[model samples]
Target: MSPLISSFRIAIAAGVLSLFALPAGAAELSKELSTAVTHAGLAAGSPDLKMVQTHLHHVVNCLVGPAGAGFDSGQANPCKDQGTGAIPDAPADKQKLLLTAAALAQGGLAETDLAKAQAAATATQAAIKGAE
Candidate 1:
């Protein structure tokens, strides 16, 4: 192979490999917050209390991340690759908003009534959006 062709191939190969090499916790905090918002909206729109609780749990899980307090291991994290956790990864100012969203999500999880859970979910979504 010609030297120039070999150099081009090496560069192309390096670029391709770099595409898959995302650093640990490289996902932006906004992505996780948005994911939390999505789950919260889903919870708010749920037709039943059980589904509301389920989606709320997802919101909490995403906000808190795997290592954060209130993170539930049993619930699926919709923001798994989107950052460590929205609350922990957020900047100081935005952390407060995420924390509020987390509290609302936790509250929604504790509620037994469908209306209250839905309300909490709506509030949680709003709080997360506030950080944006």
Candidate 2:
């Protein structure tokens, strides 16, 4: 194989292996989060209701739920008003993502923070795609 092709293949292999290394709960959460953010990014790119809703849903189910992957962070949920997850003061973008996710799960998808959520979701989706 050409060196470039070999390197690309190796990188892909590494990424796949890394994904497999996540524990079951964490893997599920990551997969759900990645999928939700990808969907959100495609909806409107910014302040998109679809994106916000999807992100929120996944966040609650995967990160905030009792069986969630929240344990992976070893930190309380920063976005939670009174619980543990990431931390309340995580990066602004990250905070938006987590807060929106929580809100979506909490049935409070207000329009006020949709922009932030959209940005967070889009950025996260971009990062995941870049990894691929």
Which candidate has the highest TM-score of all? 1
Best by lDDT: 1
Candidate 2 lDDT over residue span 1-132, tens digit each: 899999999999999998769555444444544554454455325355755654444444333434444322332222233223332323345545555454443442344466655655555454434322
**Please, what is the whole-model Cα lDDT of each candidate in the order they appear?**
0.88, 0.46
Worst 10 residues of 1 by lDDT: 22-31
Which lDDT value does model 2 have at 46? 38
Question: For candidate 2, what is the TM-score?
Answer: 0.31
Candidate 1 lDDT over 22-129, as tens digits, reads 555435676787788889999999999999999999999998889999988998989887778888887787888888889998999999999999999999999998
Residue pairs clashing, model 2: 40-51, 56-101, 76-84, 76-85, 77-84, 77-85, 77-86, 78-87, 78-88
